[model samples]
Structure formats: C-alpha cells, structure tokens
Target: MPEAPPLATEHLTRVVDGQTLVADVSIEVRAEEVFVVFGPSGSGKSSLLRLLNRLDEPTGGTVYLDGTDYRTIDPRTLRRRVGWVPQRPTLIEGTVAENVAWGPTLRDEPVDEARLHELLDRLGLSGFADRDADRLSGGEAQRVAIARTLFNDPDVVLLDEPASSLDAAAADRVESLLADVMAAYALTAVLVTHDADRARRLGHRGVRLHDGGGVATGSLDALLSG
Candidate 1:
C-alpha cells in the first residue's frame, strides 16, 4: 500500500478583514519532495504556508499532518513537527548557537549540542556557533535561521520566500543549501517563491496561486510553462 502523504489540505480558506487570502486550496504533498508554491505577490503564497504551519488560523477548511487533523494538535507541538522559516532572517540578539538552540530550549528540552553542530555544518556555517548573530551577512544570517528551524528536528519545513531578501548570488547559495538540507534530512518541504526557475529546479510538483486561489497544480514544468 502507498504510504499516506506527510501533509495535505482540503478546502483550505483564509480571510482577513473581508479580504480572502487563501481560497479553498487543497493539495497532497508527498514525503521527501519539494512542493513549490509559486505566484505573484498578494496571491496568498505566504498565506498558505502560514496556514499549513498554523501560524494563522483558517476561516475555513482543514489541514492534515501525518493523516491527523492539525487543528487537534497542540500549536507548539504542531509547530515543532512542522517547522517554519520566514522570508527574512530574524535572529535574536545572541550568538548563533543560542538562536539555533532556541526551539528546544523553549520546551525545557536540553539542546542537542551534536545536532546543533551538525545543522550549522550542513548550512555551511561551521565554526560559527559562537559568533554573534548580528555580525553575520544576509546570506550567513539566513543560513543561521535555517539551521535554527532544523534544530527542532521537524518532519516538514515550510519556507516563505526564504531567499527573497538576498542578492542573486546569495539567493543561489540559499537555494543550494535548502536542496542539500532537504536531501540530507529526507524532509518534506513546501517552498514559496516568485522565481519560476527556482520553482522548476527545486520542485517536483507545485501549485500556482492567483487571488488567493489555486489556479494550477501539477508537475512544476507544466505549471510554470505558461
């Protein structure tokens, strides 16, 4: 029998102050694959990511993680299992290690030093553990932010314009880093990006959002070809 997908949504909708941000969007994301969310600004690409992560409440519909309704799960637990990295790197005022270890620390769990180092190394930030986070460049800080999310050992990772804040070179680096990390962890990922080439390179399948509704869903190539 085929295993259930790690994540799925049914008739997901989100409205804010009479504005519909996401409209009845549904998708099943296969395990260990990159599921791209591509669209123009204000199309609810980020809104969908937030809904999946439960950062924002949906006005209607449902989200499932591992065949269980996400709303039934504790928000903190759900967030830990399904990690999130925003469009911008928001490192706390502290060392890189502190930021990376923040997640486990919140739950009174002991930070795994070995795992922390592993994540930093994977993100190409080795030897940066003790470095002050504010001192790092955009690319480096973004890498740290990624490592921070990974430290939680999430089953799925939601990235909202992860590289949008970086320059061309830095964006490429972040993209490469994400691909490598996803492979290393065998993670299920949902990435929101405006770059069509990026969607093709990283996504096996995807959905394009328009006016908070899903306009297309299929193999990335076909979705982006138009």
Candidate 2:
C-alpha cells in the first residue's frame, strides 16, 4: 500500500445560496512540495483553500489531512495544524512579537523564543520583533504572517494569492523567503495564484480550476502559452 498524501480533497464542492463556487475538486498534495492552484478570477481557488481548513464547510466531499477527515477534528485544533495565510495578512493590534506569539499562546504553550527568532531570522524579521506589527511594509507584513504561521509548527499551509499586492522586488523577496522556509521545514503547501510566472518560479505540481473542474496540469511554458 502507498503512504497517504499530506493533503487530499475528494470530490470537494462548495455552494452558497444555490450558487456553486467550487464543484468536485479532487487532488492529492504530496509531502514537502508546493502545489500551486491557478485559475481565472472567479475560479473558486480561494474557496477551495477555505474548504481544506474547514473555514467554510464543503457542500459535499471530504478534506483529509494525513488520511483523517478534517470534519472529525475540532475546528480550532484543525486550523492550528493547517494554517491559512491570505493575500492581505491581518495582524493583531500589537508588536510583531505579540502577533507571532499568539499562535502558541492559544494552546497554552510557552513561547519558544529560540525557534521564534530562528524563523524570524529566515524571514528577515529578527530586529523587527519589538517593532509594531502595523508599521510593516506590504512585503514585511506578509513575511511576518508566514513566520507567525511557522511558530505553530503547522503540518500544512494554505496560501491564497500570497504576493498579489506587492511590487516585483518585494514579491520576489517574499517568494525567496518562502522557498527557503519550505525547504528548511519540509512543509507541504497549496498556493492559489493567478500568475503563471510566479507559479513556475515556485516549481511544483499544480492544478488549474475552471468552473470548479480542475485540470491536473502545470508547466511554466505551457501555462504561459495558455
């Protein structure tokens, strides 16, 4: 028998007010690989990520993390394990340190300062620990959001248009940081993006969503030509 995938969605569907946003999305995300999800504006890529974390319940189908259905687990506990980072990160009203510490704090776990600093170091946020979280630039905020998610030691991370709002330079820096962290931690992730170039640079398996039916394909050149 084969080992279970790190993340799997089986015939997933999401509907709101009789409108179908995502229909029958099924895919297996392998371990330690970045799986990019690309599609048009209303292709339901974001909806799929929300369904994986159970932030939005699927109208039908199942999301399995490590082969166990997510619906059977506590929502809060599942979220901590399966972290989601939005395009525009939302930080709490406090210093950067406080925001990063919030994750472990929720579980009554003592802050792991060494590990925090280590992850912050990777994110270029070592010195900004005591700085105000609200004072960060667009790219810096995204980096901070990523570091905060890492603090919880999540098994899987979901990224929705992670660098959609950043400039070229800033976005490149953020992507570089992610590549480094993902490699170092061996993290498994699914990222939603409209940029085929960005998806190519990330270099992984991918799927394109159209009308909720996913095409199991991704090749930078092919995507660019399409």
Candidate 3:
C-alpha cells in the first residue's frame, strides 16, 4: 500500500449556532508541499484550518495526521505537532526571545537558546532577540510569530492569511520568507488566502471554498482558473 499523505481530512464539517462554517470539505496534503485553501472573505477558509488542529471541534467527519485520526491524539499534543499562525500576530508582553521560546517552555522543556537564535536568523530577525515584542512593526511582529511557531518543530503548519494585514511589499516579503522556511525545514503547510497570485506562487495543489463548501480542487493554476 502507498504511504498515507502527511495530512488529510474526510468529509469535515463545522457548524456554529445552526450556521455552517465549513461543510464536507476534504483534501490531502503531501509531505513537504504547500496545500492551499483559498476563497473570498467569509468563505470558511479559516474555519476549515481551525478544525485541522481541533481548535474547534468538527460537527462531522474527521482529520488524519500521518494516517492516524487526529482526534485520537491529545489536543495539546496535537497542537504541538500541528502549529498554527493566525492572520494577525499576537505577542505576549515580553522580548522576542521570550515569545519564541514560549512553546517549549510550556512543556517544561529547556529552551534551546541556539535553536531560538537560528530560527530568528532564518526569519531575518537575527539581532532583534532582545527587542520588545510589542514594539516591532506589523511585518516584523508577523515574522516573529512565524519564528515562534517554527521553534516548536511542528510537522505541519497552518497559516491563516498570514500576510493579509501587511502592505504590498511587506506581504511579498512574508510570503517569500514562508517559502524559504518551509523548504529549509521540510515542513508541510496549509495556507488560507484570498489572493490568487499568492496561491499560485506558493501552493502545489489547492481547493477553493465557496460559502463553506469546496467549489474547486486541483493544481493551484487550475483551481484558480476555475
């Protein structure tokens, strides 16, 4: 039998207050590749991502990580393996280093100072370790958020409109940085975005959501064109 894909969902659905946020969405993510979920605003892209890591319970169906059902794993453990980065960066009241090291710290694991610096360097924040997290610019804070997620060594990363709030140039930089880090770490990613060009640039295969359902699925180019 063929090895199962790194991440997948089967007939997943989520409804809130009798309103469906995601409906019967299913997709497979190949290892080390970027699988995109793209759609117009309020199309349930973010909702779908949240279910993958069980940030919200699915109303129906399930997600699989490495062929095993994700629901079987502990929520905290699942989150550690499947890191999430939201659209806007939310940093605690501390220095950049503190934020990046927060994950391992929670697990009572010793923070690897060297690894923290390496992640900062990779995210182009090499000398900002001691800087206050709250004081960074929008783009800078977002990069710090990405670094924080990577420091956990997750097998898969979920990014919800990661650059949506940035200026055009800053958005471009963040996207480029994302590609580099994913490649360098062999990380599988699921990115939610409304930008067709960004999808084409970053996604290998993707699905487009429309009103909480998957309207199209295939290679990024075909999905966007359809």
Candidate 4:
C-alpha cells in the first residue's frame, strides 16, 4: 500500500456569518505532490486553505498534519511548518533581504544566507537582496513573499491565487518557480486558483468547490473541463 499523505482533512466544515462555506469535505495531500483547489468566486477555496494552516478554524471536523491532529498542535508552530502566501502580497517596510529573513529571525534560527540567495535566484530575483521591498513591482513583491515563506523551510506551502495579479509572463514565471521549488524541496503544496490551465500544469490531483457545499475531487482535467 502507498504511504499516507502528509496532510489530511476529514469531514471538514466551515460556517461563517451563518453561511455554510464548506461542508464535510475530505482531502488527502501527499508529500512531494501539488494538490490544487479550484473554484469560482466565493466557492471556499481560500477558506479551505486557511483551514489547512489554522488561519481559519473549522466549525467541525479535523485536520491532520503528518498524522497529528492539528487542533492538538500550537497554531504558531503549525504555521511555521505550513507556510502561507496570500492573494495580495504584503511586504514589510524594509529591505528585501530583511523581509525574506523575518521568519527565521522570529524563530531564532540563524539565517542561512546561501539558501536565501538560492531561493531568490530560483524566483528570478537574484541580486535583489538589497532592494527596498516597498519599491518592488506587484509580481516582484509576490516573488519576495514566496521567498519569505520558503525561508521558514516549511514542509507544506499554501498559496491562494498566487499568480492572479501578475501579467502573463510574470504568472508563468511564478508557476515555473513553484514547480522548481516543489521538486527541490520535496514539498507538499496546495494552491487555490481560478485558472484551470494553471491547475492542470501544477497539480496531479484537483478539488473543485461549488455552491451548496459540494466538492468533487479527481484529475485536474476532469475538474477543469467539467
């Protein structure tokens, strides 16, 4: 039998403002694989990603990371293990290097300069270490956000519409960078996106979210072309 996935959700449900965002959704995400959540606007994709990282608590059910119930774990520690990149990139008021190093610094881990450089290079941001983050373009800022998340050495990365704001070329660059990162780090990734093509390119398995708390999981093409 195949090994169990690193992340699993069992009968997960979320209700906000008396609205049922997600209902009894179950998912298994294996290590070294990219799993994508695709849906139309307000279909609970972002809410689902938030649940995975504990950013948003589920109204009912459980999330397991590496076989441990996430509710039993500390949220901060869980966040450290599961990185998140939001839809809008928000950079601190500092140099690019500082922002990239913030997570490790907070954890009291000595910053690994070589790894930092490699991540920047991989994201096509080589030599941007000294640039002020506030001055970066939208796509560049997004890349820096991704670098910052990677700096934590998280085993799982959750990205919500990472490429939505970028131009075509920049979006493609982000996609390629994510693929490289997954291979290099052997990381499990779950991304929320509306772009079917992007999901097909990034994920082997796809989950589609719809109204009435319906979820269908299968091949990327099946979800996209449904």
What C-alpha lDDT do the candidate models reach, one value each? 0.92, 0.87, 0.93, 0.88
Q: Which numbered prediction scores highest in TM-score against the true structure?
A: 3
**TM-score per candidate, chains pooled:** 0.97, 0.95, 0.97, 0.95
| Candidate with the larger lDDT of 1 and 2 | 1
Higher-scoring candidate on TM-score, 3 or 4: 3
Which parts of model 1 have CA positions greater than 4 angstroms off?
none
Worst 10 residues of 2 by lDDT: 216-225
* lDDT, residue 106, model 4: 80
lDDT of 4 at 69: 93
lDDT-wise, the better of 1 and 4 is 1
| Steric overlap count per candidate | 0, 0, 0, 0
lDDT of 1: 0.92
Give lDDT tens digits, candidate 4, residues 1-226.
Answer: 7666789999999988999888888988878888999899988888888899888899989899888899998999999899999988989999999999999888788999999999999888999999999999888999999999989988789989998988998888888987887788887889889888888888889689986254688788888888
lDDT of 3 by residue, 106-143 (tens): 88999999989988988889999999998999999999
Error of 1 at 35 (Å): 0.1
Candidate 3 minimal-lDDT segment of 10 residues: 178-187
Q: Write the per-residue lDDT of candidate 1 for residues 1-226, one digit (tens) a residue.
A: 7777899999999988999999999999999999999999988999999999788999999999998999999998999999999988889999999999998787788988998999898899989999999999999999999998988888899998899999999999999988898888888899999899899888889999999999999899888986
Q: What value of lDDT does candidate 3 attain over all alpha carbons?
A: 0.93
How many clashing residue pairs, candidate 2? 0
